[model samples]
Target: MKKYISLFLLSSILVITSCDERFEELNTDPNRPGGSVFDPNLLLPTATFQHGDLITGYSGPILFQSMWIQALASTSTGGANYYSNADKYVASPSTPNYIEGNWNVGFSLSSRLNQMQILAQQRGLNNLNAVGQIMKVSALSVVADTYGDIPYSEALQAQQGISQPKYDSQADVYNKMLSDLEAALNSLSASGDQLRNDVMYRGDITKWRKFGYSLMLKLGLRLTKVNASGAQSWVQKAVAGGVFTSADDDALVPSDEANGYSNSSANALNVPDDIYEVRWSKLMIDYLKNTNDPRLRIVAEVPPAGLAANRNGLVVGNNDPAVQIGLPNGFDLRGGSFDISNHPNFPGATGSGGDVAIIGAYSRPTAIYRRRNAPVFLLTYAEVQLLLADAAVRGFVPGSAADFYRQGVLGAFTSMAKFGGETVSASAATAYINANPLNVSSANASLKMINEQIWATTSLFANFLEAWNNWKRTGFPELTPVNFPGNFSSGQIPRRQPYPAGESSTNGESLRAAVTRMGGDNWITRTWWDGGN
Candidate 1:
């Protein structure tokens, strides 16, 4: 009996060994390549979606940039003030989590894009490689714009044994971005096969090319203050290369409520906590109302109900542009003091009751602003036209600045109709453009007008970070700095955000060196292109 059991055990062991030898082969799906092989098509969608998520996500634009630009204001006071730190410019001991999250998202996407580029190159897929390069440029630009000096040259070089990469100057990063974009534009051909999972342009190589050139135009405009000659050269190159001529070529991320791929603004601001706490800033509301801008009704909503009703239940407001009132920045719910009599038409609580009056009287964003599946515009034809207007004003491109400016205004209204629903018709857009035509007489005046228009056009779905950067570069719209107590920058708007604190422990030497080179790792420290206050 012992001999028979030993033979059975030996047979079982042999059978197990045989199965182990063929295990990987049997489990591997022939349709899907496992392990080393990567499909660029599959990777493209991930990069694109992440890029959209990062730009519109709370971490990147909605929370910081939008507030910085004064397009949105926080109503929370005391302990419950969620974004009070950002609004008041109170410097924490370390970088905010959202800023760090934005940095990580950009670099992570870049790393994946690097892998996609290598695989695409090996496969002789030029268009795929170009797309990867374009994405890499876009991702790294966000990093540069956010933190000034960052890991650029040696970034994502883990395969080459580079764990701790040194920081590169913002100028170098911008130059490299331009070069990579130019190369991408050159590599893309009409004959090349279309991308399988392109979310921005479907499979249209022409639109892709236009998007690249438009991005180049934007980057070129960023250097206007720091490197005027360089800015002109690149702007001219972008104009000659061709850019988005119409709304059809606009780079937008389509939203789907079913799959949880919704608009980032709605995701961040539509929640009950944020909806009641966040309202339109006095600056944005005043500007639109004063200009008689048709977009006001689409962007803002009136106060919900009477003071008693508001306290009982959170009843929403009507979408009347005339009744909208923006909340002033630098005031918390308890600290806010407004003249209630000024807004007799306001449906919310009247009289002077501090938090109740301020919170219940001021206009919050409209439902369109909080729509679940509203598409987020990445880069639009309006932006391209505005950039061209700037270039033309600077004598870098042909055509009158007024012409491009008018086109920009018209394009912005037309594109924004998507969010405004059926109410914002083409005739309404044309009428608005006609009413507010570019009437500046001189170049400097034209620049100021153009940039101010750019500011308003970029307020809603367009990239607010770019608007903040534009404000930093041009000093247009003339925003007054909030002088809250315990503010970080001596009551001035911050020039750049601090680097993440984790870098001090993980990449200590490089981070210290960057801080030293950048003067200090504080918010007041300006980037290479800021040209100081």
Candidate 2:
């Protein structure tokens, strides 16, 4: 009995000693850095890369906005029927999956950025915190813009025990985004720690400031339809704070293809189905052709003879302007009434018999766009210049709308060379600008011309979502909505995408409240910034 009690006491003493002295030491992970030691700079690259991927991805932009804005069109029949979600405004089996993309990815990234901000603040890393703020807004803006009323103020607070974030109004979201952006832009200091993991600007704080301001300009312009005075105020603020002055200042994040990170846009375009079916829209090509835009040949190509070659992703096509014809939207390959063969003024298919190339004559995007390592352009100097042009026309800023327009045109032409294609000569670009000068005869005419250029520029750059968003805001280059049978929007263009179906199950009450506030959770419902009450 005495021996047993002694043994038990010895074990108990050992455990008590271990708990008091070595418990926390053993629990501490030697490999992991604590909050103070971990560098917040590491978070910026992740947010940057993921955002680049999100925008350029197959689901978010490619399957929806790319066709919605008539930048690219596909025959939604047979092997390519999945494209009906985009081209025909019709749902596919995977439509629910696609709808969840922006909400799921965007909020998750915003949460990561918010985490970075918290850590940076704890460590007194002001520059990193500022970058985090800007990036968080960028991520959240995509969600808010796409779905209308998204969880903004209470979003990304899962760590704070708020699992179901209440959706904020789009107007409130925009106001908060603008305020956050302004504060962040003003906080950037060149003297701070070098951003070791920055993939966008290589730790160039000045360029980051420019990017923030440019984004602010865009967000401000979105309010033009709803609050013109607010738009003017923010536009002036952006200009005064400085904006992208050159192509070099454009925000681009290159895909880490060598590390197995494929450029999603390029990956999607290179897919057999997309490559075989997707082509430049007639709406897009007609405007480019009518203006004799220098980019028409450089950005488009007609595939070689036969179905095999057309479907062959390796074959570079003829880029001659005369050979480039755009495919009409809402057509199909079912060989029925809606077939491309039956369409008016059909530019006959290329091959015959079993090797027939149905869409061979229509202009497909150039091979440069399919390169796996292609840089994702976030925002560019061309867009900034053009937006400034619009502001100028509206008397929101002091400048010649024509000069700003000219700069925008020139910037766009210069930026096109980044695709590793034939460069439009500076002289040729200048000539085009001079030939198609901004229609300064009246404010409306000038606004129309400026925004039309914006549409064209964004389209050619493959920034399809921005193109669609701008169209919604400005109503320029008025697109003819395809009234396909059984479209979700009753022949009207979709104003906003529906919230993901899962929200109804997971965040049911909040989702219901937002749906009610937004009038209804459907495609035709306009957002608050889109002039909806």
Per-model TM values vs. the true structure: 0.87, 0.93
Q: What is the lDDT of residue 421 in candidate 2?
A: 74
Backbone clash pairs for candidate 1 read: none
The TM-score obtained by model 2 is 0.93
Worst 10 residues of 2 by lDDT: 1-10
Clashes (N, CA, C under 3 Å) per candidate: 0, 0
What does the lDDT read for residue 428 in candidate 1?
A: 76
Residue 427 in model 1: shift from native, Å?
Answer: 2.5
Over 4 Å off, model 1: 1-37, 78-80, 91-95, 306-316, 335-358, 420-423
How far is 108's C-alpha from truth in model 1 (Å)? 1.4
Cα deviation in Å at residue 58, candidate 2? 1.7
